[model samples]
Target: MSKYHSFNSEKNIKYKLPNEITLFWNKGLFDSFIGIDKVNIHYAQFIQEQVECPTIVIVPGRCESYLKYQELSFDLYQQGYNIFIIDHRGQGLSGRMLLNVNKGYVTKFQDYVDDLRYFIENIVTPKSSEKPYLLAHSMGGTIATRFMQDSPNAIKAAVISSPMLGFYSGLLPKSIAKILVAIKLKFNNIISNTPWYFLGQKDYSPVNFTDNKLTHSIPRYQYFVDLYKKNKIIQLGGVTTHWLAQSIAAQKELFSKIVQLKTPILLLQASGDTVVCQQAQDDFCQQLHTLQPQSCPNGVPSNIDNAFHELFFETDDLRNKAITQSLAWFEQHT
Candidate 1:
């Protein structure tokens, strides 16, 4: 219900930075803090001048930095809301875990959840006493879910887009893929002290727009590609065997702990997503619905058709609807 949504995709498909968004980005605050194991975690924020407003805490996906969320943050800020985004460890401007910076790795999946807890308690709550709404995407969704379970009353509401509750197995069945990853991870641990990239995974490389499965809008996709081209610090590649193993273990724990969630949440499913399993999202919602039917309507995600993994960066037509729905969902809880 804000006019800022009209600026991005209404007139033309061409991606032009809006003057207001540019100004917003220019004046935004940037800072960092020491996370678990002394990792320096970077974050960005936009505070409204001389006005108290609701806050949105963005938990970005894997290989995503707060830098990639400029336009999205600007859009939400224009709606009179404060915006905060964190660049998680092993990616973004934050510290990397491996000697090879491009190899995605994490010592423990719970470290992400702990890092978020530190951000909320030490950073977000001090700035805004009001419980902030959570807007998490992909891998961030998994992190947010665990955080909510840990401190259920901390957030007023949440909107998770294309959550990575389950891995997508290309050729092998899910059970077989899990077994393979586990076996490879154990083999890797014995042979090498450091984590190795999963089979067929490599360093940072650009995919052609036509071949990319992230979004449909060429301009929107190009916008992010240009950012990565400009900054080598945030150019992250595929996951390591250890990272995949950690993620699988975390996913297994999530299902067992679903009954602990207390905050209201909305899961937005990308119907065409090949990055994460849709069946997993369905299973999560079905389990969550038995506990809180109002939070997840009818025990399933709110579907977005013709969308890829990156719902926020999708073509205007798709992205706008997803944003509108998320904003409305937050307003309901507020």
Candidate 2:
């Protein structure tokens, strides 16, 4: 176990994964399902024996594996809900697409939706007749949104935290970033004949805690850092030009097809997020509200002040509040 697993009080915050949660994770069922193109999609589930409860399907963010969600799974299970998390293909424990395993690439964004559909139809529903709720984060939010649009009635309710409706172009304008991605993608097609990493993108490398932009809790961040270090197979590098292109195209489609969504979804915005564009999340809610008032309620996200990109992995205060709100939303529809 890493030193981060030990509870500590610092700066008026306490963070630790309890032994019982670890035991619960140890009992989890880790498995994989065949997705489109025969890509192996890894997933984890924690179901109470002979206990019927509404399931929570967790779609994680980009570069995330189901291993990173053990604490989260345990937390939700303790709340009387079964938890299910999937490691999207080309990342995590799932099958990689390119020979260079570090490079993140996807054939298309729809493949992600199709994989989730296959998983729910073949694996989740057959085991549990109750319709599952959705808890998707970051890039997973984007994939889950598309999934909801494609299969409107698939899930009961959804909680999308810091969704990747748009990318945060660091130090560059969004237009310039799109142009650069387009140029690089064209160059790769005409010259490289292989996927090229986006500018400044590289293989997985651990960054110092002080420099990370994902979360505010040092212990929580350190735990995942150590986890990736020990489990190199789940360490994924930065995005490829192809993956970025697919994501951009998917965002466009998501906005264009906003009216197709029927599942009720709660968009949780992180006020301090620098990973995805907050404006895009707002626009998505606004548009969704116009189409279906019941889906978004108002034209705005339930903002979590001072929270970072990874809401669930944030400090106890932020993480607990988000989970509580999500559970409340699930309970309402149940």
Candidate 3:
């Protein structure tokens, strides 16, 4: 384990390191030998105190870097849990899939799921003695649910933070969006590649803290902004039509399979969230509640009053509350 006494404590970053820790990142090429294509994937791990602890794998939201999660991981570590996080393809420090790194693009959603499975099977499962727990945020939550649907035994329990079970499609209805996407997919055949943006989406222009809907804590929010500013690899622009279509399809499929999920899961609903549909979360949790309550293979839902999409980056009180609630949920099913 890479031992660390502090996380640049002298510099006064958001949170100070509290334990002997190891931090390392894996920079690997996508070799067909492993069947991961040519895409490069970035992964980071944090081991705390050399203690016998259960592993917790975090899948961050779209356009997010694992570096944005350092404080949360530190808090989890203080509670005696090991950490592993992945920066998905086409985003973060991972290799970009398109000529325009700022534009989000993916051939299909299954590729993302496969990549996560590869990471778990090869990187996490062998190193840790305990079955890892999953904690997914936004798009990560969508991918995590899909992963659980296919491989339920991979993780002991999971906590989804404001998962994208449903999207805030805004003025566009589902029928219209699907029809538009179908048209774009058809256009793909005529053109080499379709470059249609999602409605009025644009490139990565830094949103001032006041206009941002992500988090309430300006300081914590700015901390990540600085990280993105330092590295263009961690920055992503507007969503493409293909990504929007894939997100809709993935969430639709995952919700359909909600009744069959045997994994113990908790859906953390953000009461003040505008990014994803809270009604969709309630719908899935309602179905999960039908199977079991406070038990394995059950989908439990909790609302964090006055919270936003980025619960982990919220105000200190709210952030700590989320971290505390998550630890409690993980322990319940562990």
Please give the ranking of all candidate structures by lDDT, highest first, separated by commas.
Answer: 1, 2, 3
lDDT per residue for candidate 2 within 1-334, as digits (tens), equals: 1312222222332344556667788898899988999999999888877567889999999999998888778767766777888899999999999989999999998999899889888888877759999999999999999999999888999999999999998789999999989999999999976899998999999889889889998988888888888899999999999999999999999999998999988999999999999989999999898887866667789999999999888887888778877887887788
lDDT of 3 by residue, 15-131 (tens): 332233223222212122132577888887766558578989999999998867777776676668788888888788787777888888787887888889988888888878889
Native-to-model Cα distance after best TM-score fit, residue 23 in candidate 1, in Å: 1.8
Q: Where's the lowest-lDDT run of ten residues in candidate 3?
A: 24-33
| TM of each candidate vs. truth | 0.97, 0.94, 0.87
Candidate 3 regions with alpha-carbon error over 4 angstroms: 1-35, 292-300
Give candidate 2 regions above 4 Å deviation: 1-16
Per-residue accuracy of model 1 over 49-81 as CA lDDT, tens digit each = 845699999999999999999888987887778
Better of 1 and 2 by lDDT: 1
Return the TM-score for candidate 2, rounded to 2 decimals: 0.94
Q: Candidate 3 at residue 304, lDDT?
A: 86
RMSD of each: 1.5, 4.1, 4.8
Candidate 1 segments whose C-alpha is farther than 4 A from its true place? 1-7, 10-16
lDDT of each: 0.91, 0.87, 0.77
